[model samples]
Target chain A: MTQIYNFSAGPAVLPKEVLQQAAAEMLDWHGSGMSVMEMSHRGAEFMSILETALADLRELLAVPDNYKILFMQGGALAENAIIPMNLVGRKPQPATIDFVHTGSWTAKSINEAKKYANVRIAAAAPDGRFHAVPKRAGWNLHRDAAYLHVCTNETIDGVEYHFNPDAGDVPIVADMSSHILSRVIDVAKYGVIFAGAQKNIGPAGLTIVIVREDLLGHALPCCPSAFDWKIVAEHGSMYNTPPTYAIYIAGLVFQWLKRQGGVAAMEQRNIAKASLLYDYLDASAFYRNEIAKDSRSRMNVPFFLRDESLNEAFLVGAKAHGLLQLKGHKSVGGMRASLYNAMPIEGVQALVDYLKEFEQKYG
Target chain B: MTQIYNFSAGPAVLPKEVLQQAAAEMLDWHGSGMSVMEMSHRGAEFMSILETALADLRELLAVPDNYKILFMQGGALAENAIIPMNLVGRKPQPATIDFVHTGSWTAKSINEAKKYANVRIAAAAPDGRFHAVPKRAGWNLHRDAAYLHVCTNETIDGVEYHFNPDAGDVPIVADMSSHILSRVIDVAKYGVIFAGAQKNIGPAGLTIVIVREDLLGHALPCCPSAFDWKIVAEHGSMYNTPPTYAIYIAGLVFQWLKRQGGVAAMEQRNIAKASLLYDYLDASAFYRNEIAKDSRSRMNVPFFLRDESLNEAFLVGAKAHGLLQLKGHKSVGGMRASLYNAMPIEGVQALVDYLKEFEQKYG
Candidate 1:
């Protein structure tokens, strides 16, 4: 097998150990003579897998007792609409929601929320640069809004919130899609925190939503029952046929995370990896990362070559060097290297070496 | 490795060959040096896999040019609400939806649809006894309904529709969750056919929806953009990050189905398999099936022993004999053998032999 590191933004690289264990258990999971894929979601074997995954995730994130974790499908994009649909009914008909438009994701959250509520852009990073999060104090939140929403980490723009904003009495709903497990958090601060599993958790199909107990039964009449937090919580996320195999794999990833010393250890490694690449990009004239230093994402770092002509050659060479998916999102044309919990420091070192080699040849 | 037969209703048994190929390629799919799980959904590798899957499924069903096959998330339960959210906009506000309440799944669909539309129970099977599909002549369908909804196969009831009822000009939406690939049908007859990929297909999470082209762009304002069929179709089902790994497995299953001679050949096998078990049950004094003979599901056969006390012993001995998941739904206390596309005739024979042995010993 080739020694390779994948840098795709999402549906991205998973740990080799996880993949190996999954492969070993593909035909017959734990001598049960049935693959995880073949087990009924309601069966004893799968229920235990789901329970363990939920528990491990709670332990890793130090989630508060007030929160209920929901394993759902459809990713962060779906959450954009689901959040508003589930929350807006907290107020009267045509309720309002406050949003901090940090980047592409929150901007999207605002647009989707508008379909279900009266959206007030509480704060927005200046210009279309998407390089920084607006200061917490700068937000002009609605006094009695249904919820204040924010995208803590922007996968495309490389911006991330360093501080949790105080929304007073209103609950804050944060979309932590990209950098969810990269740092420690006070789960008590936000009313809800959601992350699509592709980046740091497990797979794309599973969307993890952590909500306070009070936030459960208030979904709007138009909210689909399967997506209604109350129904999902009551069924233990089995209101619908859940992404069972993905949940099983996520449980395995959670166990793997615990084995690697939980979220605290993961954060330290993420900081080290992010710094190594950012320091090199800042020091070099050949490449530049545009996001504000303090607001830059530790999970996804998008940088550009000083000269545009060498871009194709850079990616081609990177692939040959066993580096892959360096191309940035089409919406933001450049390159991005996502260093998730599954990504090791060794992978970062190799990426740095490749950057230097490519610069020496073309700088 | 122990050879086991899985009789689970869903997340059910897959073809042995498919599992073997999947296990062999789990670490590195098709020499790509990346597990299918690790591939980027937008990348060429996964795109090729997705394209082939759609092409193969279309070929297998002989799907028409006007119908688009959408690979979605959230399963059929979610689609119950999603359907009304998308179609009600085509008519006046609070559009009426006519439903046939035959069994558990249809009742669920009707309840979910009520949240989005004015639901009319066009027909009902009495006292929750799912012994038969209500005859079409007895249905009191709303003349101005937005759509007529039916569950082609009731997984819990062990009942199936053997005929398609006309809805005048109103489109028909069929929840074919448990029996989708077990038979061939005319695609043009229905406006939409939706199924969760836990049975006959491949894993859960991935949902298959075949909808006519005209049903595309009528989603109500309350409909989540991610669940909106028009927006989803336009984005190639990538409005949200899809269930990439599940889709890949489904593609594999579709390829496997093709090798076993498409839906037509599989239908013949299913008919024979259903006949074998049903004939034996009818001939025996110890066992009985309650579903109407004409409407009995070819995919799920639920039978009860005359001596209910023997149930535990029967299951315990069956498990020891390598037959698994024969316990019927808790709501219906009996045994069900789900003969999906993956169940070989040999496995059916084995179950039949066990039934005969048990009856002889207990009689």
Candidate 2:
């Protein structure tokens, strides 16, 4: 069988070791005679898995003690509404939320927030091309805004914010769905950091929400109890039956991350892997990543072929050569290479080699 | 090690063969060169898995051609809010939703519905100590109700509706989270049958919403697109990631169900298992199942010991004997033996044996 590299933006590749370990323990986890999926969330076995996963994730990100880690569902798309519903209640009725729209994800946050609050576009990249993250000085942030929303990494447009933008005393709410744990960040710098656990984490359906303690307990009346951040934190994300199997797999991935020397080590490798593809794309005439170099995401690299007609042939040949899911999102037609932390440099190198071979044949 | 019998209400036991298969394919599914978790939701491999799973589920339940099977997230707790958000839009402002409050789960649903619409308790078994399902003929359902809701199986209160209630022309929405797939049902009878695939299905996080085609597009303005049944059905449940790993496991479980001679065969075994445990409890002075016999849930049998003081000791001994999670919900404060389809007659026999042993020692 040909060695394959999956470049799916989300629901993307995972560490082979994690998958192997999961498979090995499917019938009986260790000698417990139960699959992790079959274990009760409140059982000692699953509780230990959940605790270790939370602890490892905290350590890997150097998260502050003041922050609470919540394992949630509905993904970042759902968090778009949940964040505003939970945060806007801290202020008066119809609270205003400041949003710096870098790309599709931030725009989604803005749209969903409109359901619960008044949303002001604090800053936006010109013309919706999502080429770069607007500078902090360019932002028109509201001084008393309930929160400042930003998509730290736009998976579709391939843009990332390298530095946390300070929006005065207003808390910064980041949609870190794509790039979470692929690199390190000061947890205290943001009021809430939420990521859908697909890329750089574990699987779809499990969402990780890290919120500062102060942000707890201010949910709008309409917010469902299961989604109320304070309630979730208090119940340890078990107010409802959480995504248990997803959590277990995430724990396994966290363990894998730790084995690879934690997030810092993974971050270094992510940087190297991403650079290999981006550098290659920059040098190739047939391919071009449109995003500004400074804002290009370390996790997702969306690029277009010089000749648009070659898209299908390019993907077809790439797939035959053991490259998979290189197709960009339908909303953004092209190619996207998502090199998350689980993606080794070798996979990226294989993709780069395939890209070159394809270009040499069809450029 | 003693063979443990897991009686968890949910996040419950799944088919052993399904777990074994899942474990075997953890690293690479059918040599597709990627874990199901690693495949893109849009990729051919995952798409094939998703399609087959959906088709098998539809066939197993005999779901009508008009009803779309939507793989969703956030569990039934979230669906309480989502249901009204989608259905209430069909009526005017403050649309009244009638609910048959049989037990804890339905009560929770009623509470959540107040946020989206005016909810009426058309029928409740509060006076019956939540031990009986309100007879269908007794329910005073609102003629103008947008939908009538019911928790067909209450995991907490050990109550199950043996018959579907007539909701007039008003759409019937059923939360069959615990006992879904344990027995076959006519899908066309209800406007929607939603179940979180944690109990008789596969895992938590994967909520299956089977909605009739006509009921798809009436989402209220406040509804999140990800939770909007219309958007979800239109997108084939790929509007969001749809909990990939959980869905894969569910597919495996659906296949396992077929191998076990489908729902009819499983239902027979379930009847035998429930009868064994219930009969033993009735005969023993030490243990008592207080739920009305007609309303007793085949899936969850919540019982109390005649001597309440022995509760702690009972649980301790049960654990020592490898009887796990027999402790009932905190609210109920006793014991619950959840015998979902995956739980064998042998497990129930073991529980009955233990009950007799305890009775011999203490009766």
Candidate 3:
């Protein structure tokens, strides 16, 4: 079989060792005589898995003691509405939610919030293109806004926030879906941080929400009991039947992250991997990545071919060389290579070599 | 290696073959060089898995063409809130919804729906105990009810509906989480059928919603877009990233069901399994099942030891014999042996033999 490297944006590549361990334990977990999938979520076996996962994730991110980690379903897309429902209740009726519309994800968040609150676009990309994060200085934040929502890493547009914006006394709700565990950050800086687990975490079904303790228990009357963060935190995320198998896989990934010396080590490797590919793309005239240097994402790198007609041939040759899912998102018709933490430097090098070869063949 | 039988209520046992196949494909699915967990939901490879699973499920259930199958997250508990949000919009503001509260599951649904609509208990067990389903003849369903909700099989109460309730022009929305696909039923009779995939289906985190076409677009303004049935059906459950891995396992289970001669054959096996266990409980003075004979669930059998002191010893002996997770739910403390579609008759026989042995040793 040919060597393969996957580059799908979310539900992307995972550590091979993690997959192997999951496969090995698929039938019976640690002599329990039941597969992890077969164990009841309330059982000791699955409880241990859930606790360990939560602990490892907290330690890796250095989450403050005041923050609660919640394991939820429906991903970030659902959280778009859940956030407003849970947070807007703390403010007055017809609460205004401040949003920094950096890219596609924030746009979705802003639109979903409109159903629950009066949404204010605090700042947006001046060019109407998602190539850069709008400057924080220009943001027209509302003093009485419920919360400031931002997509710290725009998965589709390949834009990222390198620094945390100061929101004064207001809380910051950041959607860190794509670049969550790929780097280390101060967990205390944000009022709430949420990510769909498919990208840098585990599977698509599981979502991780980290919110401060003070942010609990103000959900609107319409909030689903299961999605109410306070109720979920109080029950240790078992208020409803959680995604047990997905949580188990995520626990395994957390263990894998620890074995690799935790998130800091993974971040260094991610940076090196992203640098290798970005450097090659910058030096090549045949390929161009249009995003500003400082704003570009280390996790997802979307680029275009100088001659657009060679796009299909470039993808065909890339696949022949065992590079897979390199096509950009439909919203942006180009090529994208995601350098998530699980992606090794060798995969990046192979793709760089392929890029050089493809440009030479079609120049 | 003990020959173990898992009797977990939810996050329950799956077919051995399904687990083995999933293990084999954990690293790479069908030579795609990516685990199903690692594939994008929009990509062809994952799409194929989703489509095949949906098709297999439709075939096995004989779902009508007018009904749309939606793959969602948050389990049946979340669906408790989601159901009212999607249905109550059909009627005017302060819509009245009717419910047949036979057991714990329906009680929970009634409480959740009260958040969105005015809930009326159309019929309930005359006695407070959940021993039997309320007969349809006694139902005082509202003529203008948005829908009448029923729990076909209450996992905790072990009460099963042996006959479909007639609601006239009012639609019947059944929560078939624990007994779906174990028997044949006419799909056209109900407006919506929802089940959490942890009982008769696959793992938790994936919920299946089968709704008639006319029930699709009545979502309330506050309904989360990801859980909106109309939006989900339009995008084929890809409006938000689905629980992809769970769906894949469910598909495998569907295939396993097909190989076992579909739901009709499973119904025969289930009848035999339930009969063997129920007969033993009835004949033995040491054991008793409280559920009415006509309403006893074929999937979940909750029984009690006449001498409650021997409960610990019975469980210990059962575990020693590899009959695992036989403890009853906390709400009803005794024992529950869930004989889902994946459980073979041999496992039931083993449990029966153990019950006899335990009774003889301590009677």
lDDT of residue A33 for candidate 2: 70
Question: In order, what fnat does every candidate score?
Answer: 0.73, 0.78, 0.90
After superposing candidate 2 on the true structure, give the runs of residues whose Cα lies further than 4 Å from its correct spot. Answer: B126-128
- Model 3, position A7: C-alpha lDDT score: 85
How well is each residue in A1-363 modelled by candidate 1, as lDDT tens digits? Answer: 568888888888888889889888888888899999999889899999999999999999999888999999989999888998898888987899988887788878888888988988888877856878888778898888999998889998888888877798999998998888889988899999999998887877999999999998988888888899989999999999999999988998988988999888988999999999999999999999999988999999999998978999999999998888899888888899998888888889999999999999988
Candidate 3 Cα deviation (angstroms), residue A106: 0.4
When 1 and 2 are scored with TM-score, the better candidate is 1
DockQ of 3: 0.91
Number of the top candidate by TM-score?
A: 3
Model 1, native contacts kept: 0.73
Residue-level error in angstroms, candidate 2, position B328 = 2.0
Q: In Å, what is the interface RMSD of model 3?
A: 0.6
By summed lDDT, the worst window of 10 consecutive residues in model 2 chain B runs over B19-28
Interface RMSD of 1: 1.1
Error of 2 at B32 (Å): 1.2
Q: Give me the runs in candidate 1 sitting further than 4 Å from their true place.
A: B126-128
User: What are the chain A TM-scores for all the models, listed individually?
Assistant: 0.98, 0.98, 0.99
Scanning candidate 2 chain A in windows of ten residues, the lowest lDDT window is A26-35
What TM value does chain B of candidate 3 have? Answer: 0.99
Whole-structure CA lDDT of model 2:
0.88
What CAPRI class is candidate 1?
A: medium
